[model samples]
Target: MSLRRLLAPLCAGTLLLTTACSEGGEVAPAPRADPPAASDPGEGAAEILADMSLEEKVGQLFVPTLTGTTPEESAEVISAYHPGGFIYFPDNLQDTEQIVALSNGLQDRAVDDSGVPMFLGIDQEQGMVSRLPVGERFPDAMAVGATRDPDAATSLASVTAAELSALGINLDYAPVADVNINADNPVIGIRSFGSDPALVSELMTAEADAFEAGGVVPVAKHFPGHGDTDVDSHTGLPVIDKTRAEWEEVDLPPFVAAVESDIDMIMIAHVFMPELDDSGEPATLSPGIVTGILREELGYDGVVSTDALNMEGVRQTHDDGEIAVMAVLAGADQLLMPPDLATAHAAVVSAVEEGRITEERLDESVLRVLRLKLRRGLFDAAPVDPGEAAEVVGSAEHKDAAQQVADSSVTLLRNEGGVLPLREGASVRVVGSGSEEIGAELEGMGFTLAASAADADVAVVGTNGARGDAEQKGLVTQAQDAGVPVVVVAQGNPYDISELPGLDGYLATYSSVDVSRAAAARVIAGEVNPSGRLPVDIPGTDLAFGDGLTY
Candidate 1:
């Protein structure tokens, strides 16, 4: 089927203004549960615990990655491992129908065999880490931060949660609470709110509360903090050398806010902290950080999830089975994206049977898992209907809300030096990687694209700042040298503009999502006012944090 044909149902409308809803209605935020007590499973919790076998209980701790878009396609693994739920990757997604059907089938099979549902999850944080893609496009966290409106993040989480709920996705590993303290931090730049602890904490809480209010479980991530590291953890573990006092001041606030706001889970990053644990274990495998600090000291009785176990950060040092055991021992409630499902499941099973992991310890995780599922309303609800999913997934309202957020997030870093809100019919020459898409979009909006920089009145270039690649910078440099006023659109992080300081105008959209892209075009073309303030500092420029210009 054509993409529009498939996307229409899932990505048709934005959200409606309704009461007591996940979509943006004026509802009292959901009640935050105090840290979970070990015995405090809801009514009939004991009976539910009694009915579960050791293997089944172990399955609930694992949110394994599935390789297919259908339950039948993934049946063998699902049947063998009996994961607590599944975390979908791009590999498992096809189109809208396939994913909706996949979720329904998975839920049906789980209930038929185990009498309990599973937590279907995705890292739909928007921007760089989005999984299970389709429907309304949202600006990433940094873009939301640029707006400096917690409500924008709330709206983002609201529509996102509504879409996931429509697709039977109960959990979102989202609202990345990491404060982007290090400019060179590879993974968490645009994913974080901003550099400030207070801003990150405030926006993180607002977004988490919105997700919960929208009937989706929001997970705050990279506990302790992954924002200060210069290395990418997906390849190797980077050590954080911050003192305990420094961490408490800078890195701990967002997580504290998340826990206090009753975030459903906190995804643990795999970075090593020399101060917290001298044994050299990454936080994912460290009981000191996970149990001693997060569980006991912080008193966050919510679920604790590991970042994808398959990532080389934690995978290189130990085998999958060992990682699974260690994660449990560390007091993590859910195991996310375990690489070898069979090995991890089997290891956990053996750990329990051999008394390496006590039954009571296992139940705490299981009870918390099931309790989270209950909060997500998975038990009373039917599997997401494939037919109705389209209505909610890409509703017009969601698209509009996303565009509004994107528009508000468009930060003008250096626009006063030149002119913006370029006239609609101006001869604009757009040249850069992915410029054709923007050119086509602008062309459709009645802006004429000049054949070359020499022929155009002005030149606009689109590129990612986080990439810091020469080719993207080279294209803009050529335009600047050609005597054309160059307007560089920083599509990822705004830091890349540091490489090309002579530009007449610079805009940071914080992402390349459709809404962000469209917002950039509108703001540049004078159609929409640029309201987004800077969420992060531009390393080599005078634009400080929280700077923006509007026409």
Candidate 2:
């Protein structure tokens, strides 16, 4: 499918507001749960645990994305397996009113049958990763790293969680713990904080605290790290060949920090680490990685979830049944987006029957999942007021916060030949694929968006995919065709700049968001002096770290 079609459900306007009473209508924030009281005996717990059928237990292991399924379909799916949790994609969300109806409906089904609330999750990492269209989009992890303010990170996460929890979402798949190592890395570039491991660790801690404070469980993800690889796991697998010391210093720190800060879950990366696991398998299914290292050595007892099983990294190598069996044997507590439920469920059953996966292991995940549910007060006699759904989406306060993040994250890479500070009356030609971002951020800036090559004094262009030799050739042609004082913006990587034809100036903000566009606009308009430096070496022999032309 086309990218737009793929993202349509995600970016669709499903979260429309209704005439429901405002959740903010003088209702005080819910009170936090006190420590379990002595008077509160462990009553009915055994019978509740005992009533679970094998299918119900197996279903608890799977959390699928809600796509191509209606509320009735969702209810049927839940009824069949009695899944312990449900994760939402943009398809599941429309507006607050619809989502509220959906969530309440789903929960009502679960309560009517099993008498337990289902865990609701979303990828609300804020900024580019946010699933909530109207919700706040904070600057990416890199921007938080750049700010060097833990409080800012905490505040951003808190606001994100408050909005998410208000919508009945209990879990946030966020706080990317990966450290940015490869500038040209397809997926985790801007998503990570920076190249520094310590900074990422600190930021992740702050995010976890903020999420928990707002009554949302934070899930740190893509462990041990996806930042060093150049390949996108969405399409294919990538390998990281780091020594033990390298991992300890780089990839492992942020995860350790997150664990220490009491983060509730971790999503394992699919990339293989040959150095750590001799089996040459992705870390998600490696017992040595997930069980031995993360659990035994590092002392993390929280939930361990796999990244989407449909991702080519894992799918290409194993069938649904093998993947499910291996993941549980490897000590993963939950499986996300497995392609086939029957096969996966059967695999777990087979493993249990064969003694490869023990009842204890199943109980381990069950207890952990139950603890989270208990903390969320799912067992408590509380009513979910459907009218409160409007409060779950973007509010005026959230949008303003998101805008601030976008504005602050803009960084300037380079401006030489004094081509910048463009003449006030000079016509400018902006040519690029990310027209959406440019229009959103720079439309109000002095320069007008040029429709053709002839009507401009300066030309701007952007590269969409990989940052290698192919991009170099394309940049050169665009610069020559425009035939003006050219300015190139590398949205992904700074690689191959030497290949692009001579230009009066070049800027690298490393992303194509409104923030990056705003930064480029300010630099071109001479409103802000260029201050951002190159974080990685360009793809040439001469360039090296700490040697690039720092603006």
Candidate 3:
């Protein structure tokens, strides 16, 4: 069947099924259909934009950070450009109660003044990138990828969307579509599902579908791809020099899958892909890439938002604000985290008034943005029940789901010399940065588990040892003070393990997620054998780790 036919019934069903669950078992089911077909939200957005002075249009283009500002200050900052949307930061979050109230208040004010509901969004990527003060975080994407289970990914997203939706958040910036190409990739390391485009595509598309099915929009981010580069976009622009053939085979396939899956939005990256577009600007601002390629060739009609403009990657390099203007002229519908809304607004408005950015292009973008909002039922939907925010934020079900993902994601990196599967109550010294309990409630669960590192037969070293050089040296000295053979685990970055001292065994989980931590814990306890192998190779290491033990 054609996608449209399959989707039409779903979209129709979604609109018809508005049954809310009444504080009981078996939550309400989804529309069982595709989301409502995309359409312009009428002349409302354009009418408003038309009435908007150049300043307002500029504001509409920006989705600014609401961190570090008072309610009044928040109002003032947004009031300046009347930004199109607002992205939540850690600062804007405190607890479920505060977040719900704040989000509702912000959206209310924007609508009352501007007559349009602002897109309230969060980067609730579950595990590591969560913004909720206390809530469920599923295993990292790598874990889901490891499972290679699209249903698991979809279920995880469904639960996440339901929780975030109850708090009044409409957009989830997640399902990092970047294939895990660079194993040592500092930022996207474990954040990615795995190294294969097909796997990442399938898992992410299912998750995106689940998000939309749950009434929250899913945004596939850091496009054309952030998976292959060695540099972090947060600090500097990383150049991907792969040829068109390689990109099509690997880097670009996942995004193509996501678009075909009908993802609501795409967040473009700021990295320079010299082979694809040698304009020396990030894909976010490159007209050739945005308009000529994404729109003309790829045929994606969804909103194209920029990665945070505050990042040095794009901010330091672009002078004429050439990238921002060019992106819209190219085909993007939204400008996210703009460096300065007013400046961007003026540039866009002046360009439009002067015909540099044709009115047709502006209309096209506004139409897409408005259509997305309408499809989300933003304007018609009632405000979330603020009182119930706490009840829903990090409910027991959510946390349990998170724990399950964590456990399932844990992989045994390596076990040499048949040292694993140790006898119970064996003498062990545990030491590592990731070994410490990152979870708050796990302390009470230690009756069956080891209460402390000294209680074990094996000495394990972990990343929690030292935060800095001074602290790191103190960690080694502390371990030596214990006078036990130790196995060290590196959680954050593998580079720090180069100087690890007084360790008999070494393991790296690459993240502090409960699954990896628990895997390390289980390895020490001898409850579960270390059968999984390392997916990424560490430089200068003689050890070759695959997906499973050799013996």
Cα lDDT tens digits, model 2, 72-162, are 6677777776777788888777777666666667766665445446778888886568787556566667666645568768878988887
Each candidate: RMSD to true structure?
Answer: 9.1, 8.8, 7.8
lDDT of 3 by residue, 27-126 (tens): 4643222222334556544434454444555555667778552355578766656777888878777777777777777776665445456788889887
TM-score winner among the candidates?
A: 1
Clashes of each: 20, 5, 32
TM-score-superior candidate, 1 or 2: 1
* True-vs-predicted CA distance for residue 433, candidate 2, Å: 2.8
Per-model TM-score versus the true fold: 0.90, 0.82, 0.81
lDDT of 1 by residue, 1-551 (tens): 21112222212342111112345443432221111224544643454556667777888888888876678977776666667788888888877788888988887676555656778888899877778667677888999889889889899999998888888788898889899978888888889989989999999999889989988888899997999999899999989998999999999999988878778899999999999988888999999999999988888998899998988889877899999999999989998888778889899889988999898899988888877776666665655667778888889999899989988899887775556877657899997745876787788788899988988888998988624587777888788788978898888877887778777888899888877888888888888888888877777678788888888
Model 2 pairs in collision: 14-94, 14-95, 15-94, 15-95, 16-95
Model 2, position 371: C-alpha lDDT score:
66
Give Cα distance to truth, residue 194, candidate 1, Å. Answer: 1.1
Residues forming the 10-long window of minimal summed lDDT in candidate 3: 1-10
Cα miss at 161, model 3 (Å)? 1.5
